[model samples]
Target: MAEVKSMFRDILSKQLPVEDITTMVLRKPKLLPLKSLTLEKLKKMHQAVQETTHQQEMVEKEQQQITH
Candidate 1:
């Protein structure tokens, strides 16, 4: 758990490079198997991206209203 927390800190602090994100993920700890979980996570992440894009559009629209 400490390792996981340290990894998150590295990510949040940008101490880890962009390429290292892939490295960290692909080289995940042996305790948790992720061969199939990664794919499922990717799918869920795609959905989240879509939702965030929609929310961003709504916020932009509201900002336009506020300006005018």
Candidate 2:
């Protein structure tokens, strides 16, 4: 419980859109073993998500430029 709440708070603090956070928590509950993860692990996961999102945005931008 406490760990789960802490992970939730950490995710919220990242300033992700509420819909995205909700989807992340609800859509893939099995993917995140929040109860078993350490604080360090949670931070790493957050960083990875951010990096992946950035990469996705860059890819979309490149695709748009190519099409234009």
Candidate 3:
């Protein structure tokens, strides 16, 4: 997670555009945080967050590669 955050920082430092990042990070359908979410629902939300974070890292990596 820290590595992904650092990669995102690196991408922004290199002036990669934010639109792509936002799309990659936010386009996924997030699980609703219901007060009564079952254990499975909680797990799905965690999975979604992990996947979203991974996608952001991938986008940042691609952008950095292009800039270099």
lDDT of 2 at 20: 68
Which portions of model 2 miss their true places by more than 4 Å?
1-37
Cα lDDT tens digits for candidate 1, 1-68 = 99999999888887766776676434655676556887999999999999999999999999999999
Candidate 2, 1-68: lDDT as tens digits: 99999999998788866786566333644576546558778889999999999999999999999999
Error (Å) of candidate 2 at residue 16 is 65
Error of 3 at 63 (Å): 0.3
Give TM per candidate: 0.42, 0.45, 0.45
Residue 64 of candidate 2: its Cα lDDT? 100
Give, for candidate 3, the lowest lDDT window spanning 10 residues. Answer: 17-26
* Backbone clashes in model 2: 0
Residue 30 alpha-carbon offset, candidate 3, angstroms: 34
What 10-residue stretch in candidate 1 is worst by lDDT? 24-33
Q: RMSD in Å for candidate 2, one decimal?
A: 25.9
